[model samples]
Target: MAGTSKPAVYKYSRGAQPGTAARTGDWRFLTPNWIYRPSPCRIACPLGSEIPAWLEAVKRERFDEAWRILRRSNPFPAISGAVCFHPCTENCNRGQLDESIAIPELERAVGEWRQKHYRPPAGPPVTRGRVAVIGSGPAGLSCAYYLNRAGIGVTVFERAPVCGGLLALGIPQYRLPRALLSRELEMLKDDGIIFETGVAAGGELPLDRLNEEYDLLFLAVGAQKERPLNIPGAEAAGVISAYEFLRRVNLGETVRLVEPVIVVGGGNAAVDAARVALLQEGITRVSLVYRRTRKEMPATADEVDAAEKEGVQLYFNLSPQALRLEEERPAEILFEQTETAEGKIKVLPAPPRSFACGTLIYALGQQPDWEALGRLSRELTLFAGGDLVSGPSTVPAAIQAGRLAAAGIMERLKRRPGTGEAQFLEGKPVVGFEELNLAALPSAHLTRRLSDPVAEAGRCIGCGTCSSCGLCALYCPDLAVQWRRERYDVNLDYCKGCGLCARECPARALVMKGGWEDAC
Candidate 1:
């Protein structure tokens, strides 16, 4: 009787019964997870640029689409490509293979190419509201761009004769061309963005009046107030702030200086000032002093390298204590030896040393003029960003802050907001160097091109995303893996949960988990 007992059989149907599926583990089967993890370069960007997406588009020879995608996050790609510190390149995964893609140069090339064919998009049809923006710096301009594109009229007021605040007067021509800056600003102007140059927001147009006139207000006055060295002899004849020096030089003013000029601080401004000092007629040498070592300096590595190449003597682990003046003119400076210990500044007991120099240019830092905002009246919806809110930062950071402010304003205006995030993965398992299966990738595709952007994009690791390399299906020992409709599917009838597919995944996008099934 026991040997003759009937064998039970179950037929699967797409019905409501949970335990009546063809495969015993239909609902509780192990799934091969595929996700697009955030690339390190994209994560490093302040503007949240979809770096990999554009890079892929470039690889496919979709230049216009790539340009459009790039512009979605960054408005001034050409300007940014020229001046950005490019932290993205530093975080590039391709560097592990051979050399990091020349992201900045590629961006510059594509950006300039797009600039030749750029046309301002048609303004939004519905008139939602009007807004007032103070300052025409990167932050203000970016804020106005977003607002104007959203069918909101933006009136930008700049105190300078030209619209670009720092881009026009702070950055030198050799680094950022004025013609290029002017041309990019023209795009914003053509978009119906009102630019009122030579008009100070809190001066010609009072804050109270602006509040009453516009429904919303954004203040991005920037850190125009240069922080000065709090030491004696700073008021000497040749002792001047770096901002004033750079501004005057950038405005085409003739600046004549004596030999051996000293520029204090290690930030970007300090490096720029030192380089500018070397260009003066009588300046034979430029000396730059910083409290920290070269590793801890805040300026970009390329800037420091360029300054060194341009004959700027760098003195690190030295802090300026005082300036010495001879007959009311800068002649020497005093410095204190310092070191960073346990993340704290430690000034040693060594005696202060003196160095001889004709002029002193101090660029310690800059502070925003918060008082310029006046009282925050409850009657007005006020917002601020860039250096005004976050202190001194980079141009891309300012642009990102401006975008955030625009979204906040749009929400207040009862309008829908745009997706400010990049098209990348989040919270996925990060593939490490050891986890990568590089043998599946061809060695020829690993070496990228320097001059070719499309070729350069091929070197990307495509972290946490399937590259469809066929390694998973090809290496499946059980013959359970099947490729159908551009995706891999595992036949549970033959699969033994061996996890060979997950191990052989080049992108590390697949993972095997514990699974359960109801056996009838």
Candidate 2:
């Protein structure tokens, strides 16, 4: 062809062009970045609460609005803010850059505002379906909160004279104050959750009576049984179990263990037990013995550090061999040093080493007492202990048992004498916030805010659920997150239980099981 000018060229005004006098296009749009990105903290939450949105409100000093948004998912933000084991902190992208934001503290600050202005929601009508929660621990309380919010009457039966099972009994005062516990209880009571303190459920209350009366029953009994130290002189005096020690402290008992205390185990309880033992000035030497190395220590890093800080000496790669009771003097806590091979620590090897201490605290672990559940033993046998055993192997496992039991009951109801149209309808998430334009989101990366160790109240020693981020309410795109006077509720129908909320969740709350699998 003639005068084709080598197929000519055209250049555009925006991006890379034809190299001639042509127009370029959207160079900025070509930059590949989400216009609106969700905060990692919000995305990691279980409730799927609008993290960035609420934070944006807070950044603008909209205290009222911030609380309003927060309360939509977590009714107990103030309590949870102060106590939730903030899992979101671990997942905060900012942590890689610097310290994550003091999310729990921020939550507490917002919760403080909410506490001042927040009003519990009043219900329209009460349903005949009554839910009886066995123990007044977090799981029980949480279940009660949601059940009550769903308009079901709830009754919490606790064997202890007081409420807040772990919150009241297991946790140290420095961490969870009694007043906060009472206030949270008051909040629940205001929402119509009944508490039968000092009433034993499996014994005096009886599940049969509950089943006969209520539409359904939920058992949230936590494992309180401390692992037994079956060794020579095991029945001797001055030996305290973790459960006993925590219970005594929680119930305000004055126990004085002699100096040279040897606590066994590397878990949080072991640390807590050792530290608490130090409160007894007579207890001078507090050493922890674990068969594992420092890396394998199951206790939270903070707890292990705190134990060391508080003068609780730890001897890793060691296990208690036996307890030698001198009848009156300091008991001997015999231990054997351990070794590792092929990445696994070798315990009870041929000829082991041993150490001696005064008072021996077997913090090996705890188990759940399944004797109470014996009535249903033949029928609905739920293992609190691992492997369908009658008892739970640990306190946390017991709590898990309670939750499983409750979930099972809920699932049974869903299958049997089923949910109404409104019941299933209510399970759907509520829509609130508008869709975010990911393309317009912040150009800056996740802003990590280092958490101040100084909790206005105290430090959280790994207990309970609900990570401080309250992410469950934040990341929920459907806005299904809501809170009633009693507690938090996530509408499952609308939730799809995508578990994006779960996987991203810092604290393993807002659990999702058996879902579409690709929603995340």
Candidate 3:
């Protein structure tokens, strides 16, 4: 009986073989492919900055690399970091988790690192193409920088005694430190970019002469002409536009301010005017009057909050009716109660209220003076950008416009057939928060300003970017994903198309494509 049982016994076993032994991927209908899509923040950014790549570098404390990446898109990170409204943060996917990344602060940090470490190269003179960039604002500076970098001779013309059109003349010292601006300009100068101050393009130098001399011309004169307030006694002696007021103050002119100053409009200019007026000597009260409600105000929330904290009185739903003049100077301003309905302002039937105003500053925005350019403005070779073309846009937008103009100039210079159109995020698919595997990412609370930027940068989830976290390889049922040559590769021989790896990708970098027909 024992001999019979031993003879009948047979061994049977099954074990996992190497992925190379089987072509299991042939059985798959769908295939996982690594695809890069624009992140929501990148799409929202006017400059289209590669936020994830730079943030990754910043996470590793590679400040130089981060700065390099940042400068590729935006030349004035420091200036923009300070003044930018940061629309990028509004669309940040991380905001859905806890808080949006402090992109502005990080950008500023990178800019500061650049200021400390970057040294202009003493290379040979750029003798290739001659370009004259009119105005020294963000757009003009950005165009000049890119053109000069491309080995083109660039000369920037500024009407003001000092460079930086709006940046130097409009923005207050409290918001943007003069030292930082000076350092940036000095760096550009050292890089062989020429700057001619006290030279107006249309006036002294003449735009016709520049068009004849330079190979190409880029005009970024900016919107400096203030929109006049259409009200009774608006031309009173004490009444002035916010642009002119800020310009006078920024230029260090000795202007005496009356006791109580009234600022009209609800934009950043109005807030800046109110805040700046509060800093003046003998100025006790500064009131901001807006025709719309707080929510309808165009100023950034941060700026509004700062204005409130600085003792600036905010009066909403009040429209300026008329100014009472005493001896040809504004003495009291009459405002009528108003409300917005269907995007239109309607004055209430209530009697107009009067506020004592020693000085009335109108912050009704500015417009470009195209007349200043004359016939040169309509020239084919004259490319205009910044506030001149886009009205009063953000600094980052102006920078992007400058970059685009530079590309166009370069294209025309080379006699390229196609128009140098920038590849925008308009048609590209943007990654959403739902596409990410949140379980794989580490949770972090919002830390706006940490002593170490690396810690803050680590909070970035790197949406739409392959972070090489190895989660795809770790979660794969079959050992098809291989690490080779510093990157992840799918073996395909053993992939079953289960989509586990793609589902586990926290960065949403992997996507499943097609069915059996596609694989075949």
Runs with alpha carbons beyond 4 Å of true place in candidate 1: 1-34, 122-127, 375-378, 419-426, 443-448, 465-505, 509-520
Tens-digit lDDT string for candidate 3 (1-520):
5564466455568556754676788878778888767898888889998887788788878888787778778877888887788888888888998888888888888888888887878768777789999999999999998888777889999989998888888888988888888889998998889999999876788766886778888999999888999999998788888988999998999667786899999988889999999999879799999999999899999999999999999999999999998888889999999989987999999999999999999999889987786746556378889999999877788889888888888787873322222345567689999888988775344455567788788888878876666788998988878787655777777778888888988889888886653321
Clashing pairs in 3: none
lDDT of 2 by residue, 344-401 (tens): 8777555655556567777767656667666542333222212124342333233334
Best by lDDT: 3
Judge candidate 1 at residue 45 and give its lDDT: 82
Runs in model 3 lying further than 4 Å from the true structure = 1-31, 375-380, 415-423, 443-449, 468-470, 473-498, 514-520
TM-score of each: 0.82, 0.67, 0.88
Candidate 2 all-Cα RMSD: 13.0
Best first by TM-score, ranked:
3, 1, 2
Q: In candidate 2, what residue range of length 10 has the lowest lDDT sum? A: 26-35
Report the C-alpha displacement of residue 276, candidate 3, in angstroms: 0.8
Clashing pairs in 1: none
